[model samples]
Target: MRIGITYTILRREELEIKERAGDFGEVFMLHEDDMVFPSNLDLDVVIIRNVGHFKALYLARLFESEGIPVVNPFTVMLEAGDKLLATLRLKDRVPVPDWRAGVSEKASEKAVEELGYPVVLKPVFGSWGRLLAKVNDRDALEAVLEHRKWLRNPLYGIHYVQKFVEKPGRDIRSYVIGGEFVTAIYRYSEHWITNTARGGKAEPCYDEEVRELSLRAWEAFGEGALAIDIFEGSEGLLVNEVNPNMEFKNAARVTGVDIAKKLVEYALEVAKA
Candidate 1:
């Protein structure tokens, strides 16, 4: 079987996948910069690693059009890649953070008023906690919204506001592969945002609630490898966010699991079926 791994910027996870994939089948590295509509799509399966690149999605859809199996199918990517869509899809199925979407500053402020102070404002399409803001008061909310209004990208106009849950300065990052819990890590930070990309430290976690919630969240998205971020609320674990293009290098180091290998094995299984 011919397997292809698509990436924009090479990372440790991609490098590790390339190294370990030789044992399963022939591995090809698909660079995003050089991707073109090939005359003949030859790969049996493709694992998309470029999380935020539109080109990767285009290629994945092209491959799917030719009957090639793309891991974490473009359909899943479309749903999971957008914060508003994911929240709407998982509503009532999982305990997602209370959120409201708006296109104007007045609507955003109204959402803040309804949700209360210190709401989290996030871009509709982004990852790694980039462009996330916490509005502590009406003035701060207005200021942030005013700044966003001038940005050229119309995406900034679409405000995705959520109620900020009080936590113990930590969150759980759980890995789920093929609808099963693989492993988890505790990301600790002084700030509310505990993403590892922002210098948060990772430690192995063994919480049953986290495991159960992670699996439930994965099932809410149907099938695929997912990284479910859970926040420790007063009641229990709340599903914070679901990442389709999940980064697991830190999770792997803390848990000692070969995540890439498991992903490749799952992809091959899907291809065979």
Candidate 2:
């Protein structure tokens, strides 16, 4: 089997995944620093990782055009990379937080009003809780919208307003690999945002409800390797986000699962199929 991984700068998890891939087949690390499509791709399967959504989509399409299988295929990336798109897909299939999306500042303000204060203002495309604002009032929402407008990035301009579900100062990050729920962690933090990248602590959790919802969420995205960000709402587990390019170094250490090895094995399985 020939396995290829798309990456920008190799992170810890990427290096580990590459090493594990050696056990299965010849491994190729296609560096995205050049952002150039390979003139020739000799790989049977690709595990897309460590690249942005647009870049990942580009590579997935390129590889897929040549009949090379891509894990978390282009369809998955298209929906998971955009929060609004994911929300729309998961809203009917699984439990999800109340959310609204708008293109202009006035439209966002209306959405904030409808969802009420203390809503989370998120960029349509982002991760690690960056550029996320928990707006408790209209003034704060206005300020955030103004700042986003100043940045002038079109994605930032499109506001994603989600009704903030109250939790115990934490949320759940569940891992689902190849259609099976693998493990989950409770990200504990003092602040509202509880992402590990923002200093949230990871602790093991084994909630069956989280597992079921996670699997359903994965199926909603066509079932690849995904990390489902869920919140324990008053009603039930509400999926906050679905990550196609999920980073799992912390998750592996906390769960004691060799995530890299599992990912490599799944890639090889895809190659065989």
Candidate 3:
């Protein structure tokens, strides 16, 4: 069996997966810039680690066309990569924050009024808390929406607004591999966005509710490796977002779980099947 790990830059998780993949099969690190489609390649499975990369998705699609199994398959990437689509798919089955997708200034104003103050305005395609704004008032909402109008990417023009859930300054990051709950960590920070990239500290969370809710959220996305971000709402856990290419370096460090090893194991199992 042969395994391919797609990435742009080598991160800690990718590095660990590459180093350990030898135990499973011949591992190839395919960089996005170096990928050439419609070319011959030999691989039993390909794991897409680089999220939000067009080239990576193309490569995954190419490999998938050849009947090579790609983890977090292109179909899953298409559904999980877009915030609005993921929300729409999961809103009916899972507890996601109330959100509205609109492209006009009037729509933004309507969403704000309906969802209330301090709504989170996010780009449809984004991660790591980049370009996410909390509109506390109409003036701020207008300013943010106006600035987004000039964005070169049309995705920014479509406002993705969500009602911000008041939490205890933290959120849960749960890792689900092969449709199984693996581990979770609490991303603690003073700011509303508790992403590990935003300097949030990772702490191990032993809550069964977190595991249950995370699994239910993953069920909405079907099979593949996923990271579900959940918030501790007044009613219960509300899923903030579901990531197809979820970064697990901080979660691994805090939970003492060899996430890369688990992923490689799952890849080998898929290849054998």
Prediction 1 global C-alpha lDDT: 0.85
lDDT (Cα, tens digit) per residue for candidate 1, span 15-115 = 98887778888998988776677537588898998856465567668888888888778877777777887888787778888888888878888888889
Cα misplacement distance, residue 79 of candidate 2 (Å)? 0.6
CA RMSD of all predictions? 1.3, 1.4, 1.3
Candidate 1, residue 131: lDDT: 79
Off by over 4 Å in 1: none
Per lDDT, what order, best first?
2, 3, 1
Count of backbone clashes, every candidate in sequence: 0, 0, 0
**Model 2 segments more than 4 A misplaced:** none
lDDT of 2 at 213: 90
Highest lDDT model number = 2
Q: Write the per-residue lDDT of candidate 3 for residues 1-273, one digit (tens) a residue.
A: 789988878989899989879887788888877778775778899988775556556666888888888887887777777788888878987888888877887987897898899799988877899999988998898899888887767778787899988999899999998888999999999998899998999899999989888888888888788888899989888988888887899989988999999888888877877
Q: Against the hidden reference, what TM-scores do the models get? A: 0.96, 0.96, 0.96
Q: Write the per-residue lDDT of candidate 2 for residues 50-91, one digit (tens) a residue.
A: 567788877888888889998878888888889999898899
Question: Where does candidate 2 clash, by residue pair?
Answer: none
CA lDDT, every model vs. true structure: 0.85, 0.87, 0.85
Clashing pairs for model 1 are: none
Which residue window of length 10 is worst by lDDT in model 2?
32-41
